[model samples]
Target: MADLLHSVYVADKGLIFKVSGYSQNLHLVVDLVTREMRAASGRVDRHMFEAVREVRARSYHNVLLKPHKLSQDVRMNVLIEPYISVRDKVSLIQNITLEELQDFTDRFLDKLYLQILMQGNIAWTDAIKISENVLKNIKWEGLPEAESPVIKVHQLPLGDRKLRVMSLNPASTNSIVTNYYQGEVATVNDTATLEVLMMLMEEPVFDVLRTKEQLGYSVFNLVRYTFGVNGFTITVNTQRDKFTVSHVDRRVESFLKKFSKDMNRLSDKGLAAVKQSLIQLKHTTDYELKEEANRNWREITSCEYKFQRLLIEAEAIDKVKMSDIRKWVADHFAVGNKSRFRKLSIQVVGHLPNSADNATQGESGVQDHSLQLLHAGQPSTNIQENQEEFITSIDDFKKSLPLVNTPRVELAQC
Candidate 1:
């Protein structure tokens, strides 16, 4: 345990250091994180350029070829802050000076609020001692205390907004399309319900889109909760040679339309089966010691102190009436309820010339065809006329239609 107190430093923007170990080794973990944080605050300029350059290189690769990164960019653009590209991020890091790095560390520390969570085989007294010692060693004395940074998530306007981004790497044929359905601010119950909904939707979505429809190799339904905002996203990663981004989007919408009806027609026995499966899953003690520690850390960092959130959600699942599920589906996915539900479509298209209209706008001076598609009402000149024609022809071929209401289903009375 004495040797375990070796310092670890992370040069990320939000957190300078994080230490996790078994609860029995709490003293060592606390000393390690505290020592690292203090050392980081004092040595901000040490290896700063190398650290930034390495991270920047990694980020650039992540943005170019990573499908998840593309999906995340769209989700963040619609639900929170617009995402800065890896290129932009790298450029920003390159311009930052050593003094700027030091200043950032100083300011960040001045306003830092330490959150600590101790669970499993640890006494409350020892936890308190650990906390006190960590704070004492961090040397936060005489510094102006700062509140945690307020997370202000952006609200999506009612109706649909489609954004098409061209991948910077033109050589890659893989394209990603993500549709985000924005809903109300998240509550514990709502989050739990959505989790179950995600579980229910995941397999079917994969089976239909990936297996049956052969839309893509990777297809998923993800429940996204950022700060207080909550939503679900359906994404497909496919190639332009096989299907256009617009074609993939339509297929996803088609699946949702069919899924709504299926949800309504779900028999009582079937619904109960799903619920039971989720409950059993929640009750399953499958997590290792390290996984449990990480879960606790996640809850603490997110300021969601419901350490037993899984159990709480399992209980909530039992209380979920079929009507609740139906209503939620109707509210979020049922078309024509545009006021209550907002959907954002993001397409990361590939470089096939046939599908060039949907090709992502490059950082360099490549003409962006989707610009006209997004701004359909704007007039165009001869040069712009050719671009508009290219976009409209693709739009017509794709049968770009407005979202229509899903036919209401009649469920048997419970």
Candidate 2:
């Protein structure tokens, strides 16, 4: 008889498999190996192939035609190492034959280890029986576990800045600009600090850039953690008919520079209030059953199995002083700290009446002056003088920053 195994051990180190649901509900994820082995047995027919092609084509078109998706793709390409897109996947799908996919799936499947996770109301015996029943149908011969993929986290080089303008929807008048600041590798403490800082900055950023300056309709500031790397971004979605990307960039910089002064004035009482609000939010027992499971699943998937991470963060937040928050802001946004500051700016420009001419005018009038101030290497009376200088070319931007040796995520071999 096939083995019906159930073993309990601490997952000290390894890749994660996540399952989310209520305690009474069962969730099963057939590992890639088993799924691919089944696929390799030639289950895919011509109809399935055509269906997949059509689905992928539609997805590619949606991404291409949607301005928000296009802007998100630009942001991801800038942030992710060895950037690959849905378009690239679609291209690959179009180029490969069904037989090729089967072969490739077989080879790739041979290189992956299997993981099984049971949560909620499932009993150990039930899990064992389920696993056994699933495996009984597959051709796997209890092969030894294969290695896991290595996911490399990309680090933005210090002092280097990148600017990308992706044009999408030539007929749409709306444009978007996103500025990303490369932050330190995430730790519980640092992540907590950044979260509080974002809370402090969010309203002011919007009030100044959106309401007061009238730069755009949508203005947002938030902390973003990609893989294990932490960063913060300020995004504005405006109309090319009214404003250009350069103008938005300038206004954002101006707000941030002045915000530094505001940071200094953030009284102990103000800091305390923010911390209390965050603590209250974290301590709120508002998790539904599924929400709780999903939160645990995220912890497992991120390899930070502190199921009570919010509590841990709350404790960290308690110890965070106003000085700590100021230091973090200074380290990231301070002028002349070239070795510690890096930014990536992505602009999605829309088509409108003489938009190209307006964009040039904006760039020359705003960006040229800013660049000149940066090149002068002298303190300027302007509030935006401390902003990171933008580089037009990706290659030049990469050259200015130090690269981290984070391992690239790759398929592992058996």
* TM-score computed on alpha carbons, candidate 1: 0.76
- Candidate 2: misplaced stretches above 4 Å? 1-41, 132-147, 334-339, 353-414
Q: lDDT value for candidate 1? A: 0.64
Residue 324 accuracy (lDDT) in model 2: 84
Q: Put down candidate 1 lDDT per residue, 120-204, tens digits, no spaces.
A: 6788998898888877776664433344343355555556666666554556778788888877777767776777777779899
lDDT of 2 at 33: 38
Clashes of each: 3, 7
* Model 2: colliding residue pairs: 23-120, 23-121, 150-409, 151-409, 152-407, 152-409, 157-401
Q: What is candidate 1's CA lDDT for residue 221?
A: 89
How far is each candidate from the true structure, as Cα RMSD in Å? 8.9, 9.0
- Residue 23 lDDT in candidate 2: 33
- CA lDDT scores, all candidates in order: 0.64, 0.65
